[model samples]
Structure formats: C-alpha cells, structure tokens
Target: MLLFSPVLSLLALSVVGQQFTNPVLWEDLADTDVIRVNDTYYLTSSTMHYSPGAPILRSYDLVNWEYISHAVPRLDWGSKYDLTGGQRAYVEGIWASTFNYRKSSRTYYWLGCIRGSNTQIYTAPAAEGPWSRKGTISNCYYDAGLLVDPDTDIMYVAYGNTQLSVAQLSSDGLSQARTQNVFNSPSNIGTLEGSRFYKRNGNYYIFVTKPANGQYVLKASSPWGPYTSKQLLFNIQTPIAGGGIPHQGGLVETQNGVWYYMAFVDSYPGGRIPVLAPITWDSDGFPVIQTVNGGWGASYPYPLPKRVLESPVGTDTFNSTSLSHHWEWNHNPEISKFSVGAGLKLETVTVTNDLYVARNTVSRRILGPASTATIVLDYSGMKQGDRAGLALLRDQSAWIGIKNDSGTFRVIMVNGVAMNSNWSTRSTGSEVSATTVTGGKIWLRASADIRPGSGRQGRFSYSTDGKTFTTFGNALVMNNDWHFFMGYRFAVFNYATTSLGGEVIVEEFTLTAA
Candidate 1:
C-alpha cells in the first residue's frame, strides 16, 4: 500500500516522474499573460510605474524561464512617470494586459490600460523588441485580455470588473468598434477582473478573477451578450507556503494544444508573484486547474520536457552600452544622467529630501522566500549631500549607502523612509546606524526576508573590501501590503540633498536566493 497526502501546496514532492516546484521563479512577476511562438514560450507581466514596462521572459519549457527583453521601452504616458516636479506615478501606469501574436500582420501585440486613462496598445515584430505604441482604446479597459479571430481578423478585448464588458476593436485593431456588457458577477461575488479572452471549439470564453482570490469563466456562442458564468478555481491553496490564494492570470496553449495557466499569489513584501499549473478543458468546455488530490500542488510534473536553465537572477557586469532587461528604472530615467560602460555611472539628478522623488534609480526584483543583493560602489566621485548605495525600495523602504554629510563620508543604514499622503509624497527616513570612512570604493548589501507574514526584514551590511562584510543597522521590517501594488526591489540609487552633479559608479551587482 502507498501512503499519500492530498494538500501538497507546500512540500516539493515527486509523484511518479520528474517534477518542478511552483511559484515558478520565486520572483515578483504579477498579472502575467503568456503565449507561444514556434517552440518558445513568451510571457509579459505588470510592472506598474517601473520604466521599461512589461518585462518579457522566454521559456523552452514552461517550468524554466529567462529574462529576454521588456515590451515597453519606456513608460512615456505622462510627465509624472518621469518624476517631473516631484510628481510620481506609483501604483499607476501599466496594469494587467494581454500578449498576442497576429499571424496576418506578423506582429506581436501588447494591450493594457495606462492609469485610469484609455487602454494603450503596443506592438512589435519580435519578442526581444523595439516595441512601439500603436494607439489606445477610447475608454479605459481595466485588467483586459485580447482575442483576435484568425479567420476574420476581428479583435475583441474583454475588460471591466464585477460588471464585465467586452469591447470590439476595429478591424485594424487600432480602435474600439463597439462595447457591450457581457457578464456580471452575482452581488455576492463582489469584484471580478483579470479577464483572459479566448475561443475554442466555436465557443468564446472569458476567464476572470475575483478579488484577493477566486476564478471563474464565462462562455458564449457569440462575441457579445448572453454569456453564462461558472466558477473555476476558488479555494486553491497557494503553492508558496503560507502565501495567499492564487488568481488573476492568463492561459496558454502549447504547440500541440496542451494547456497551462500562469497566475500570481499575493506573497508580499515581495508583492504578487507568478505560479504555473497544468490545466485541461472538460466535456462542458470549461477549464479546470489540474492538481494533486483536488488542490494546487507545490510541485508538479513538467508539462513539457524539462531543461536545466539559468534563472533571471545573476551578476550584471556593466560592460554593455545598455542595461540588461533584468533592470528597470524606478521611473523614466533622465538619459543624460546615467550611462553604462566600464561601470554604471549614475549622476545625482534630483535635489530631494526623499528617495521617492529621486530620479534615475535603476532596480531589479528581490527574489523570495529570501534573497541577497550586493553592489560594489566606486564612491571616488561622491559629493557633499550625495547619498548613493543599495536599497530595498518600496513605499516603506530601507538602504545601506554612503551619505556625504558636510564633506565627511558616512557609511550608514537608514530605515522607515516611507511614502505618505500620496504615492508622490515621502518623508526623509532617519539614519539608524553610521560609520565614518574616507571613502574610495565600498560594498553594500541588503539581504531580504520576504516570506509570508509581517516579520519580513531586510538586513543591511557593508565592507571596505568585497569580502569581509560588517552589519550596518537594525534589520528593517519591510512593508508587506497590497497598497504598494509592486514588490520591494533592490535599487541602485544616487541623489543629492543639495545641488545635483555629484555621481557614483556601480562597478558590479549580483543577486542570489535559496
């Protein structure tokens, strides 16, 4: 006899054959939409206000992925995205979206909303793109998904919340032709969003998610009206231990039509992170999430032949003219204020009391259950009032950096620098620990504990040499709230408390997690 346990959303188990764990990358990849091109799989997800929005990932097998390029080169929606005049666009910009390939045009489409404005559209010929904005939908299509009929080339966008709506796009897919209410959740279901529109066996389907956690699908014979809804995934346990329920993602079909669903779990202070699960359609034409013992398993057999691939997290040597796709500017950066060559040179671009208002801070997502980010800084050029170093950036943030106070360089760790009033407003955090040093070159680190619960903290450390590191400050309890919408990031920043022009050179950056 074989002993068995049903709820396997925690342990990494091997049922019969080779298996891989869930929360796929253990990185902050929320609101994901995936598609397949030839033998490769492409995925893009929400980046909120992070410039170079919608990061692209490539996978030979859905179980492993690599950073390829970003779909949006810049978040040029407004001046606020550039952090102009201390205006910020946090929790704004691109949200949930669709990634589709139009075979007729031989182009890839990226459709999503910009803030509360109209739904914006972007297209590219290739996945690693020079993506360009084509136009926008007349009305805001929040948390939308796209489906273009191959036979007719007619485009349809499923959008809206509890009161769902489907907007028909012009034949060219550049504008809206018509909009209609398709389905509405029962008053009991509350909010329903994150729709991924699809068609199969002559039936059109709209997959949607209900707040915090829950999923459902609506089916109709015609594109518009008379749609019927059915619950799909509601009480699925999170693949990540102690994480929130998984919901709000899109489905993709393999080359041979094997299906998989890529969704995210609310695993903060790392924010919502993506997870993968096999799915199958039933005789009734509704989708079902395949799991072990009627629950989401922490590990599952690879849907495709598995391959050992390098993760997106690794060292970035500043040898290329442009930063790697792994990095995103906090907002649209001032191009003239930064460059990459021998090393990343970031000139102080803003005179601000808060890091929130500082421009040109480039960052990478912090991995979980825990991860360590390290950066080597050549502070030979740091000027008075300039603060430059490694940070765990969010609304409530902390950092270990070199702060020049009255011409004296102090290696310090600051905590509780928080956003207030609004996303654009922030208070200057206090230095929790400091040590004077005649700075030349230094190393800084932020090891984050981003597991579930409120005890998450980022421990700060520093070193004169690359090796021997000394603890800098009391561990900062990171903010784990849905309010930020985005997760904590390892940011390389430089800003001035007085005048700009002071700069710092980041020699190298590396990240590792377990």
Candidate 2:
C-alpha cells in the first residue's frame, strides 16, 4: 500500500473544501458568446492570436460550461503576419463571435469579423464536429453580428464600419444577398461596433455599444429603416470607473419566458471576466439592465442543468492512434510531430521560416480559473537547444515557460529578447539525478491570481507523484495596457535540436478548478 504524508492529506482536504465553496461552473471564462439548442447550450469566445481562434464550449445550464472544440484551427488567413511584434493587426480574428442555431435547418452558424477586412462565416451540422468554413462576406466592415428572421426565412449580417449596415445572407447562409446601411451617426461617437438585432412583437431593435461612452439600445420597426436612439442601457465613461464595456454577448430568453443579458466586463487585473444580469422589460418594451451598488458577478438565480455528460477528467493512457482532446499543439501542428501506440510520443520539428508568422502553433485557451493541470512525461531524449515545457504564452514577446533542460527541469522565463531572459536559473523543490531519472514523468500545477497593479500573476509548482508539490519560487506577471488587446492562455511546447531527437511520452493529463 502507498502511504501519504500528513501535509499531503491536508492539501487534499483543502482542495475538497475549495470545491464546495465555489460550485458554480466556468468562473474564469471571458469574452463570451452563448446560444441554446433545445435543452442544450453552446458558447464561443475570442482567443486573440491564440492557435485556436474561437473556443466552442457546451453547457446543459448557462452556469456550468465544458470546452468541446475550437471553431478555427489556425489564424493563417493570408501572409505570414506577426502580431507578437507589438502589432495589433489581428485583433478581430477571434473577437466577439456569435453562435446562432437556425431552427429551420437545424444547423449551427458562427459569424465573426476579421478585424479590418471582411466578415467571415463558418457552419457546422452539429455543435460538436466537422465545421465548414464559408469564407468572407463583406470586404469593408469590422465587428460583425448575425441574426436569423424566422418569419421571413432571411438571414441578416449586421456590422459596424464608420456606420452600421445590415446585409441579407444567401440561402446557403454564406454570401451576401443585399446590403443596406441601417444607422450612421453625424459626429464621431467613437466606433459604432458591437451591434445586435432583435425582433420583438412587430418591432425591430438594435443594441450597440458606443466606443466613446458605453452602450445604448436603439429601436427600428423594420430590418432596414429609421432607428430611434433611446436612453443608455449601461453607462461607464471609463472602464476603471466600473463601467462595463459590454462588447459582445447574447440576449437570451429562457424557455420559461425569463429574459437575461449575458455579457463580459473589463475587469483588467482580473482579466475581461464574464458577468450575467437579469433583464426586465419596461412599460415601453425596452430591455432594462439592473446595476447594483457594488458591481456585477455571476448570478445563477435559476436552477442549473441537471442532465450533463461528464467526460473523464484525467485518464488518458496514450494508447490511441490520434491525439486526444487533452493534447494541443503550439500553432497548426504538423502531423509528423506526434504519434501514439505504447504512449503518446511528441517530437519537436524544425521551426518554419514563418515561425514569427501568424497561426503557426496549435493551442487551446485556458478554460477554468484555478485548475490543476498535470502531464506525466519522459524527457531523456532531449539535447542542447531541445526543450519541453509548460508555457503560459500570449504571442512571442509575452510568454513564460517551465522547461526541461537535457535531463533536469527548471523554470525559465522567455520574452522577445532571444538571449536577454532565455534559460535564466530559477529554483524548484523536486530534483532528480540526470542519469537515475531516465524517463520519468514530471507534473506541474498552476494557480492564477489577479492582484491589483500586478496584472495577472500565475504561480506554478511541480510534483513527481500527484501528491507532494514544490513551488517554482518565481511568478510571471503580465503587463496591462489600455487597449485590452490580449488575455491569458496556457500551453505546452517541445522544441527540437539538430543532434538530439525531441521526444516526450505523455501518459495522462487533467485540469480541474482549484
């Protein structure tokens, strides 16, 4: 029988206690978009510059969410563009996407703007697998929104340029049928982006956010006509002033006829976290958002979904033929890098000339806030310049990794400068002899804390067994900017050298909120 120490027992008890305190689901997701299909719910959100553009999450209830798949595998649209060199060009590759379920055809359609260029559309038969890319719609617009009119069988794509325009989508739901400008202000009221169209009882309503102020909802009787500006739904001049810039969200009406507004808040140091509020209709039939004195947080006053299919969290023996959902590449992974039989073996390939280019790596967005992520792997086949580490990355300039050097693993921080911070020495608790530990597994557990003025600080620790953990001593803190361009992500990478073949066998990996 395997014996455990008292400290290990106490740590396990603390983990159990924390779970009871926060039973709600998806406490860490941000930039969220949600859609309900019958009793099941699906969500997608921006993964700016990350390998997977938008993440597809499924939920039985609005509260608890599980990551299912990604909408776009890579952001490689055209040339080898690098957003990592402080260029904010690819901001709209995955920002503010909408998931709409067309009841007529029983198909799921996802629409998103490609920043400065045209709006792109993708469709899937089921929410789970085999999505089709339909290509760009309008070449001149940004920040696009889509809605289907059940009464007319007409699909409308609404987007914000200098003004707002609505275009009819073809029967195939890809190309544009007709285009018309719906609303355009006289003066420069920032950018009239983040628009949503809704038809309620013979009236058409459009809700948009003014980049200058906050957000206001406008009404129109027809899809394209004169729109009347109404009172502001949310007012926050500055984001730090508790003004939530409700960029992109869904106005969902429950089956029981209850209305709710799901949106995201600009909680900077806290990241752009998600918030839910109950919406009520006024005497004039306009939706009113309730703002309490303190601030907005997760509110699931309604009962959560009871019928859920819970997948195994951490039980991959790596005997399959293909990569599991548990495994992700840095950008778009080459098929030759990985193989599975006795165990999951990952080989490091030569970086392409387009290494700094767009959409090179394959990665999944970090799902929950405080989660334990572990992978049992062997790293005896690494040479100088070859590395395998768990990375918390956001482009090439902004990333940190805990890497294995030859036989021993150490915590190393990497920014843009190739030699400035590469392979800096850091301390850790566990140490295995270079020769003794030939091909043993190493596990890392990380926790994220958004401290004031500190931005997002992530602390990582390592353990041989899943029991005893030793802190890595140093923490990585992200620098915050006013633009709100980037968010948080965690990944794994293996870089190969010339002489040594970079191979790692991953036995099992799991992530559950701390």
Candidate 3:
C-alpha cells in the first residue's frame, strides 16, 4: 500500500492498485471547481490575493493531479493588488471561480470575481492559456458559478452570499441579459455561498456550500429554478484530522461513469486544503457521498482510477524562461523586480517592516503532513540592511535569511507572529533570534511537521557550506486556524528595510516530503 503521512490530514490511507485515499490533494487548494474535457480533468481553485489567480490543475484519473496553468497571471485591477504604496489585498483577489470548456467553439472559459470590480471572464483556445479577457459581468458575484447550457449554449451565472441569484449571460458570456433571485437560505442555515451549476441527465443541478453543514444540491427542471433542495453530504467531519467540515467544492465524473466530489476543509496555517470523496447517486439522481460503515469518516479504501501521475511541485533550478506554474507571487509581482534567466533574481522594490506586505515573494504550496523546503541563496549582490532568505509565509510565519548589515553578513532567523487580526490588519512583531553567519553564500531550510501528535510545529535551519546545517530559533507553533484564510507556503523573499538597491539571486529551491 502507498500510504501518505497519517499526520497530514484527518487520516491517511495507502494506494493499492486501483485503490487510493482521501484528501486527494494534500496541498492548499481551496474553493475548487472541476470540469472534464475528453479524458482530461481540469480543476481551478481560489488563490485569494496570490498572483496567478485561479490555478488550473489537470488529471487523467481522479486520484492524481498536476498543476497545469493559471487562468490569470496577475490581477491588475488596482495598485493595492500589487501591494503598492503600503496597500495590500490579503484574503481578497480572485475568489471562487467557474471553469468550462465549450465544444461548440473549442474555447475554454473561466469566470471569477475580485473586489472593486465586476465578475471577469477570461477565454483561451486551450487550457494552457494565452487567455484573453473577454469582458465582465455587471454586478458583484461572490463565490459565483457559471454554466454554459449544453443545449441552448446560453451562459448563466449563479452567485450570492445569503441570497442566491442567477443571471443570464449573452452568448459570449460578457454581458448580463437578466437576473433574478433563485433561493435564499433561511437565517438558521449559516451563510450559503459557493454555487456551482451543472446540467446532468437533462436536469439542471446547482450545488451550493452551506457553512458549518456540508454541501447541498438544488435540482430544477429549468435553468431559472423553481428548485428542490437537499443536503448532499451532512457528515464531513474526520476525528483524526480535527479540521472542520469539507465544504465549498464542485463535482465531476470519471470517464467510466464513476462519480466523485471535490471539496476543502478549513485546515488553518495550512490554508484550505482539497479533499476528495467517492460519490453515488440515488434513483432520484441526487449525488451522495459514500460513508464508512454508515458513518462520516475521512479516509476510505475505495478503488482508485487506473491512471496515476507525479506531484506538480518539486525542485527548480531557476533556468526556465518564465516562472513555473507551481510558483505564485504574494501579489501581482513587479515584472522588473524579478527575473528567471540567470537564476531567480529578486531586486528589492521597497523597504517594509512586514514581510507579509513585501512584493515579489515567490512561493510554492507546502506539502503535508510534513515536508522540508530549502533554497540556495547567492548573496554576493546583497546590500547593507538587505535581508534575503527562505520563509514559511502566512499571517503567522517565520524565516531563515541572510541579512547584510554594514559590511558584515549574518544568518538571522526571525518569526513573524501576528496578534489577533486577519492578514491585512494583523499587527506583526518580528522576533529576531540569536543566530549569526558571516558567509556571502548560504542555504536556508524550514521543516514543517504538521502531523497531529507533533504539535504541528515548523523549525528553521541554515548552512553556510550547504553540507552541514545548524538549527536556529525555537519551534514555531503552527496556527491551524481560519484567521489567515490561507495555508502556509515556502517562499523566497528579498527586501531592504533601508534602501532599495539590494538584491539576491536564488540558484535553486527544493521541496521534499519529510
């Protein structure tokens, strides 16, 4: 059996031939929506405030997935999206999105919403995307769901917070023709959002997220619904994982007619991680999640898909002409601030007391239940008061970096602990530990042990020769909470708190299962 780390989520299971496990993706991939084109399955997830918004992943089998591309490389709506002038867009940017492939035109359509703007649609000839902005939907559609009717080919968007609304779109999916309220969840059912619409077996099915409860479905004979609703999955809790419910995801069927539901749990400090479950439909055609021995459980020994693939993230040599799909900027990265040709060159843009607001911090999703990340830093170009290193970045994060002070270079480990606030308003105080280095070239690493019994801690280390590593600072207690609304990531950052001339070249970066 190929078992994952039991400490990663609620529980872990092994893959045996056609049998696989739960939480199919152990990384931070939230607000997931899935679509099948031919034999290929494509998934798009929310990357709030992270540049390269709406990452699209591909899979031949439902069990294995790989990062393929991003729908939007950068959110250029405003300067705040770029972290310009001390402004930030944390827990904001492209939220939940709807992805579809139209057979009529051989075009791919993606629609998502950002604050201060209308719902935007991006189109491409293929999923890899040289995607162009088609246009925008007039009203704000939070957690929106888009559907291109298979018969009429008319596009429809279903979105709302407490009140659910469906709006008709033009054939091009650019303009809104008409809109109306579909269904409003009563006050007792928490907040209802994250709607994904579909047409199956000649019936219109709309799946919505009901927080604190699991996901529910609304079935209608027509697109504008006089709908009937039912709870699809009520028991989504896992005793071993301890994370909350698996809500806010979409459904997809395999080539051989096997059904599965993709959703996420609020695994804090880790971000919203994706979880998968085998689904079955009853005679009435409503989908149901398979349970273990008539109870809600995390991992189950279900038959896996026949195909398998390697993970999407791994080591990078900084040799690619463009940034890898595995990487995302903290915000819209300043193109001039970083280059990939001669190693990853990160030029300091501005001096900031907070690394959370620093621009051009390239990051990749951290693997779980445990993983180790390392980065080789060439600090020859580092200037005075410049700090460049590797970090586990989130609202409450830590780093091991080389800081150039005067003419002396030192290895410093600092922990950014935020006090009682979200990412944007969090008051962070940096605690510089007692460690020093006098070398111009150094390698930094962070190991995260997020398993249950380990107390979910991350520790940092540094090596001057890249052979012998020395531990630094105290263990950072990982905050597994929704306060940050995202997962922790392995990040490479360079910034000057004094001036903006300092820079660092990252020669290599690697992430390995620990």
Candidate 4:
C-alpha cells in the first residue's frame, strides 16, 4: 500500500481537473469544418496558396488536433497569378469547405470553393485517402454549402454570386440537376452566402451570413425559397460582439440530439483567420450565437467525439526515408531540393526570381502566440560570396537573413530593393567575427512574440555549443498585415554563388513555444 500526503493528493486532483478545461485558442487553424466518421473526427480547412490546398486534420476532441494529410496536392488554379496583388492568395485556396459523410455510400464528400466561378467537389472512400476531383459546380460561386435529403436522396448546393441561389445535384453527387434562384436582398443582408439547410419539426431552416454584417436564419416550408428572415443570430452593436463580420459555418446535431452551429470570425488584425463559436436555439426555434468582446465567439466545451493526434515537436531529423507532415511548403515544394541520409542536406536550387514565386520554400507556421525555433547546420567549406544561414522569410519584400560567408557572419534585412544593416537600421551590411563550430554543428535560433496592435517581432541568436547563445543585434519585425498571411517561419537557405560544389547540411531543427 502507498501512503499519500495532502500536497500530493491536491496536485493529483489539479492534474485531473486540468483535463476538463478546454483550450481558448486554436493556433494555425483557418476556415475550419469538421465531421465524424465512426469514432474518429475529421476536419478540413482552406489551404489557399499554401502547397497543400485542403488541410485534413484529425482529433479525438475538438481541442487537440494534428495535421494528418492534405486533401489536394496543389491548388487547381495557377499560383501567384490567381492572387490579388499584396494579398495572401497563397494561403487562401479552398476557402470555407463542407465535409459530409455518406453512410449509404460509405464515402466522404468534400465540397469547397475556388477563387472565382464555381465550387469544386472531391470524394474519397475513407477519411484518410486518395481524394479525386469530381468537377466544378455551375458558375463561379464562393463559400458553397451542401445538404442531402435523406427521404429523396437529392443533393442541393447553396451559393452566392451577386445573390444567393440553390441548385440540385445528380444522384451521384456530381453536376447540377436543377437550379433555382433563392433570395436577393439589396441592403442590410445583401449578397448573402454560406447557406446551410436543415429540417426540424416540419420546417426548413437555411442559415446564411452576409459579409461585414451578421448572420441571418431564414425559414421556409419547401427547400426552395419564399423564405422569411428572422432576427440576426449575432448583433455586432452589442457590448460583447463577435469580431470581423459574421461568416459561414455549419448547423449540426450531435449524436446526443443537441444542436450547435460552427462558424468563423476575423478576430486578428486581418479579418481572414477563422474562430469557432457555440450556438443555441431560443424557445422560438431561432439560433443565437454567444459573442465575446463584441468580436468572435470562443469555442464551447461540447462533449463531442474525436480522434486526436498530438504531434511531437522537433522531429524533422531528416533521418527517415520520408518527410514528416509537420513540414509545409510555401507553394509547391521542389521535391528534388532535399535529400535525407546521415543528415538532411538541402541543395541550392533556382527559386523564383520574383518574390511571389518563392512559395516553393518549405516552412511551418509558428503554432503558439509566441515561440522559439532553432536549427543546427554546418556551413563550413564555403567561400566569401557563398552564403548560407537560417532565414526568417515572409515575402520577397519583407524578410531578414543571417548569412555566413567564409569566416564572418552578416545580418541583412530585405525590404523591396533595400537590404539594411542591423546596427544602423539603414541599407547596409557589417561583418562580424565568425563563431567557431565543432563537429560541423552551428546552432541558430529565432524567438518571435505576437503582440496585440504591435504585431510579431523577435530576435535571432547564434551558438556554437548549443548551450550559450549570443543575441545578434536588432530585432526583426514582421509586417502586421492580418488580411494577408501572418506567421513566424524557420528555413535553411543556400544562395547563388560563383563557387561550385558548396552545400549546406542541416543536422536538426526544433520549434518550441515560449
């Protein structure tokens, strides 16, 4: 028998209590939608310009998740060309997708929107599988919604162009069978989209959200309109409001027969990031969303089923034959640039000369509000012009590089055509004495802090022994553009040089939340 002290018993109870507390924030998740197949929960989100168009994440509980695999290899649309200038088109490919599980067919269907003109649908037998493109929905419509009638086996797609419209799909869940003009409102609820259809107590409910405003729940007897709009689900004028104009989500009934609405809110500086909210129905059968700070709502503590995979940090050893899912390329990764043997060696390849084309660089978004990432590399046997260092790259215009040439370290900031020196914050570069590395292991670390209004900025440190570190002068500040993509990234680089046969070897990389 074991004897327990009072302090020990209290600590044990505290640990058990923590398991019931849910997470407040979901980092690096955007345009999220979820579905449960069997006992496992599957989630999908828009991947935009990011190499993996549709990100498929798995979780046992909604709070904890891990990157499983991508639904699409690359965006069906062309890269950078598809984006509006200065916007983060790369991160915006398949926005607001709907995931449905068909028990009759034993398959999972994914319907998502491209940039313009029509929604794209994909299907796979299993949650984790090889998904194939079924084709595009009629004309270009964004933020599509799909619902299947159990009695009729008919599928309908609700989308908005200049106005919201409903269209019927074939039995195979491909192509439109019939199209109907749903509803059009000029003001207050103009151009409403993200429509979800549900039936309860003989009445059909269609929930749709208007841009930069609030969400409206419309009721009708038939699937096609002659619909009546109800009070706004959320009022922005309220004291504790939901942020970033209400957006689309799904109205789902869990196995326990409780109803909930999943939606997104633009809470960050940019109104693009997605946040989850819990919903409840009033006695009158109208849905209402609980708002926080008159902004986006917080996630609920719903006891839902899920399949969680807590990924291990700092596992990009490159010793395995295959790359881990933890890594994501900016756009499409050049598979030939990397090789894993005794260690990982990234060959210097021709990156896009234009900043927009540099999406091929592989990176992972900083997962926490603040984090520190470190990489160990061997940059020996390089000439004066030959440069290799860890880079904090955002775009062509905004980035900072810490490069080593011959025996000296140089810190550089790239802003448009100007490369500034750290000491003066002016366009210049000053050389410093080279730090010695034994066993070919040179450690480089960067720490980023995400602050409200101030944006994210951090310092870079270098160490030879991996223990003692010296901060390289000057903090690199990331651009505070919420409309565009924002995240701290770590990367190993090899630039063009006249000297031939110079290669940079990366031994290991680690990212830890501060």
> Whole-model Cα lDDT per candidate?
0.85, 0.55, 0.79, 0.57
TM-score of 1: 0.95
- Across residues 1-514, which tens digit of lDDT does each residue of candidate 1 receive? 1112222233233335888788787888888988888878988999999989999998877877878788888887789999997588888888897878888888888988887678888898998888999987769988899898755788898988888999988877888899999887888778899998988878899989987779988999888958888888887877788789989888888887889988889988988888889899888999989987777888888777765454555677687878888889998999999988778999999997788888999998988888998898998798889999998899888889998988889899888888874775566789899999875899899899888778888898998988999998898888877787898999999999888779899988878776
Question: What is the per-residue lDDT of model 4 for residues 364-478, given as tens digits with 9 covering 90 to 100?
Answer: 6564456677777776644445555655544312333444456565544333322232111223233333443444456777776543334456667777788998776456656
- Give stretches of model 1 more than 4 Å off: 1-16, 424-426
lDDT of 2 by residue, 315-342 (tens): 4566766544433444344556666766
How many pairs of residues in model 1 come into backbone collision?
0
Model 2 C-alpha lDDT versus the unseen true structure = 0.55
- Lowest-scoring 10 consecutive residues by lDDT in candidate 2? 1-10
Off by over 4 Å in 4: 1-25, 79-92, 196-204, 235-247, 267-274, 290-308, 311-314, 340-344, 351-356, 380-440, 485-503
Task: Point out where model 3 deviates above 4 Å.
Answer: 1-17, 187-190, 296-305, 417-428, 434-436, 451-455
Q: What TM-score fits each model? A: 0.95, 0.78, 0.92, 0.78
Arranged by lDDT, best first: 1, 3, 4, 2
lDDT of 3: 0.79
What is candidate 1's local distance difference test score? Answer: 0.85
Let me know the TM-score candidate 4 reaches against the reference structure: 0.78
TM-score of candidate 2 on Cα atoms, chains taken together? 0.78
